[model samples]
Every structure is written in C-alpha cells, then in structure tokens.
Target: MTVEIRVSRSPGERRVALLRDGVLAGYRVERPARPDGVGDTLRGRVVSRLPALAGGFVALPGGESGFLPESECEGRRLPPEGTILTLRVTRAAQSGKGLRISARVKQRPSGPLALLERGPDQALRWAAAHPAAPLVVDDPAELARLRAALGPRATGGAAFDDALESEADSLALPETPLPGGGRLIISPLPALTAVDVDSGGADPREANRQALPELTRQIVLRDLAGPILLDLAGLSLKARGALEPAIRSALVGDGLVQALGFGPLGLFEMKRARIHPPLHEVLADRPLARGLALLRLAAREAAAAPHRVLALSAPAPVLDAIRALPGALEEFAARAGRPLVLRDASLEEVSDA
Candidate 1:
C-alpha cells in the first residue's frame, strides 16, 4: 500500500493530508505554535470535598482548578478542602473537565501475567468472570501483573472480531479532489475525535445556503473519509435539515461518524477519526498552558509607490529569519524610512508568563 503524505501551510495553521490510492485517508491541522497539555504532575490543595460525589476540587499550584472524582478518592483520610493533594493529568480536556489521578498507592497483578500484558483489549475478564483474581493493591504495574496471571485466556470471542472489523471497515475516505482545506484546533481525545466545520460564506441570500455548516460538515466528513465530529454550537434548528445521513455515518463501526443539530450554542456536532496531534501542531504547540510574547521585526523598502515604507514586528526567531533574507535590511531601511525595531525573548519566557 503506497501512502503519500503532503504538508501544506495556510494563513493561521498548517495542514497534513495522507492519501492512499488517491483517497484522503487522514488529515491533521497544526495551529500556529502553542503549549502542551495533560501529562503534567501537579501538587494541588483541596479547595473543597463532596462526600456525595465522592470527590473534591483542587487548587493546582498555578491556580488551575481540578476535580478528583470519588472513584479515585481511595485514601482513608478525606483531606479537608484546604489539604494539599498531589495528582496528574490522565486524559485531555473532556466535557469541560480534565481527567486526573491521585499519587496515592494503587494495585496490580503479580507474573506469567506480566508476560501477557499487551492483550487486555482481547480479554473477557468482567468482574463476574474473574472474582477470585486477587486485587493486589499497589500500583499500575501490579494491576497489569495480576490481570495477566489470571486474565481470560485471550479467548477473543466475536466481540474482538467485531471491533477489529469495525475499525478496518470504516475510516475509508474518497479520492475526490478537494481544494486547499485546513483543519486547526487542539488535539482531541485519543479514542474519539469531534470535528466541526465552518463554510467560507454559505449565505441564503444567494440561494446557496445548503444547510450552512451542518451540510458543510457532512461534506467534509464524506470527503475526508474517517471519523467525523460536528461541534456546531450556535446554529438554528430548521437550518439543520434532516440528520439521518450524518447519524447513520456516525453509528457505523463504533460511531466513526456522529452528527447532531446545533450544540448548546446552536452549532453542528459530530465525531471524526481519533488520530494523535498532527506532526506540525505537535512540534509547535504541545502543552497549551500559557501565551507567548516573543517578538520579531523586519524593515522593507518599496520599489515605488505613494507609500514606499514598511515595518514588521513578530517573534525573535521570525525576526532573525527576516533579517537573514537577502536585501532584507536595505529594503526595510528604504521602505520604513525609519529603521525597524525589534525586542527578542526566549519562547519559553514569552509563553510561561
């Protein structure tokens, strides 16, 4: 199978499209440099606890508030609201929340189980299936060991084949030639992805209002081939048209496609292929925790015009690159009439603040 990968840049973000047999198999959008999220270990103070919810709120060191669900509140002592608690970001932002885990002790399985650690997805071990397996409370490691020692003998019933068939059968895209399209946003969850689409100008005045974004999103999903998520938050109901096709697409193969009317804000909603962050977006903006104040500057001269001066400002790397361009300095001098000015700072310093 030949795979052709193409990377293209747009005004605000970069796009990556993978084509197999002339079909668009995968697409990724990288935003203009940002920060990484999740995976950070933090020590937070319990702001409050809810016995009913079996959870508490934590004031993270940097002033971020997190929820520690009761399922994870295993310690004997229920730390008072102000008690300092340690935790880590397990899953990315989901349903307006971040998944977390406490640093307290946990559990695991103990040997040969260790050797079969990779096949849990294939196991049929339900609570009732393996009631005798010792819950060797310790850490994540021990949990894996115990599971393997006595986990179902990898007896992948029809369920396993069904899941594999679903994954393999869906996500099949088309070879339609699309214009320069770009998708840029934060990395979605690893298992499911939601996609939202906005048309350039689908106006009803011209009679081209083909369901506005709802239709646009559907077109994108079919064109892109893969999972589709439409997160329309402010669209009108009548404009949604019928959602049967989109819904049908979504339900296929474990819902590779999901469509809905406007969201809370009236926008379309759907799901798409669950891929990791696109290469470019991952390289530039991984942990999106803060902002960047880096600066770049450039001076340019015009050949001849009413206004023959130009001055540019941006970040340090951009400034350095601009200055290195041939005739860049002279052009800047002539165009700006006044020398271009620049202030440089480390990318980290600019964003960390």
Candidate 2:
C-alpha cells in the first residue's frame, strides 16, 4: 500500500511518475506546447452563446477560447457576448477541442482577459492529493519549490527508479502483456479508445479477470478518457455479467470513471471524464518529441564521455524545431560545456553521430 511520487524535470518538459509499492502505477507528462490548465483561474470575455449547444465560447488569454457549459454557470443565465467574467479551467484543451471552463468561483474578479492565478504544478497537485506520500525530485530547483509548497514531505534524490523508468517508458507502446500469458492491445482512436483482451489460449474468463488490474492501471496511467470500449476474449453473457462487480471494483479509485455496462454489440462500455488529453495525444507531435529526445541524448552522452564531441542528426524539420525552441540548444551547450553540431539527416530517427 506504500505510494511515492517521483518527478523528473528537463528543459521544455516535466515528467511525473506515481509509484505504488515500487511499481509505476501512474504517469503524466507536461510540456510547454501542451499546457494542461486544469486549475487555472482567469478573467475571460464571452464571445458567443449558442442556445442549441447550451453553452458559449469565452475568449481566453493568448488568443485561445474555452467552452463554458450552461451547467457550469451555477444556475445563472448565460451572459451576453462581451461580458467579462471570472472563470476556472475545469479541463484542458484536447482532441481539437478548447478548454472547458466553469463560472462558479468564490469571488468574481473584474478585469481584462488575462490569467489571474496560475494553477499548482502537476507534481505539487499530486502531492496534495496524496499528502502522505513522500515526493522525490531530481531537479534542485523543483525540489526547493516543492519544499516551499509542501514542507517536510518533499525530498531530493533521483526521481526515476531504474525499473520504474523502464516501465513508464514502455507505456507508449500499444501492447501490454498481462499475467497468465495474455495481453491487452490498447488503441486510442479519434472517437473512442478500444482495448482488446487477448486470452492467449487461456480460459477466457480467467484471462479477462487477470487483466482487470493492469487494464485499470493503464487507463489511469495513460489518462485515457472519453468512451472506452473493451472487447473481452470469448465469453458468454452470463460470464460477462458475472465480471461486472470485479470491473467496478478495479476502477474504484478513479472518481472520473463510470462503468456503463455492456453494450448491445457485446462490448463493455465505460466513460472517463475528458480532462487532459491522453498520453498518445500528448505525444502526437512525433517530430517535436524526437527533437527533445535528441537533446536529452546529447546531454547523457556529454556526461558519459566528457571529452567526446557530440553531433546530433535528425530530419530538417526536427532540427528546425530544436533550434526554434527558446533555450533548448543554449541549455544543452551550457550543460555540455561545448556546442553540439547539428546535421540535417533525411532519416526519420534521431541519433547522436
């Protein structure tokens, strides 16, 4: 039952891993391009109201707009266009949708369209939720910040446990091996996520039962939201019905998830509230991720071989992205004590040559 939170910070990205009994139970990534404004408070101007949709779009800071549902207005009528109001961000923008905002704040601050209060960092927010769990942070500045935010509970050390790091990295893969020779194939589609339970020649019911824990863990770790369709390996109606309680029990900790039971098409249906985008969506920009990865690799190489000059090669677009990111190349050169050579390679993979 022991739980710990580990945070690793790098230029342009922050990774947080939740470990339960030394196992990676949950993982989250925060990047500058994809900001998860879950708890930010802002003053926004209503742009338009659509009675048909029962919501309106509010112009937010930085040229972004959010949808404020009528239900989130605390029973107040939708304000006319051009009315300024204090708002809180309920969910981050995801899947081509803008942020979901609510107008139910304790105090309404009148002002121009701007960010009023920045939300807690993801690590601090997680620490608040699991107050008892000790926070292990790698970066000195982040550790100091966490200590100021939550005294005594934050400590300095390596954030990623070796085994847990490997496990967390593998989360990007589509296939997950289950106990008893079975595996789960998780595919995130545009409309809904689909999970197929492969029994691997074992008893269907037993395999499905064994996959429940890992399945739920993946759901939480990946932050998979929206409609999820599960296709259990060959099972009878009675067997599927019998597994309902177990499925519900497995999803006990996540309040956002609701088991909707089986559909007419024999697929098990569940819905998780859409907040932050899922892991796949967060890593959707492959070139950007690759560029960041190359920078990290260069850093590691410099540490391992202090005297070896490093040259990073990648696609032209990837190199352009790296050069354009503020402080990205500068930080690497500062840490490595030598400028890195950048080369344009037509290959898809990034490498330190």
Best by TM-score: 2
Question: Which 10-residue window in model 1 sums to the lowest lDDT?
Answer: 288-297
lDDT by residue (175-220, candidate 1, tens digit) is: 1111223222222344444444333334322222333333343343
Off by over 4 Å in 1: 1-34, 51-54, 72-86, 91-246, 250-353
Q: Best candidate, lDDT-wise? A: 2
Candidate 2, after superposition: displacement of residue 83 in Å?
0.6
The digit string of per-residue lDDT tens for model 2 on 174-256 reads: 99999999999999998899999999999999999999998999999999999999988899877787888888898887888
lDDT of 2: 0.86
TM per prediction: 0.33, 0.92
Clashes of 1: 56
lDDT of 1: 0.38
Q: CA lDDT, every prediction?
A: 0.38, 0.86
Candidate 1 local Cα displacement, residue 171, angstroms: 19
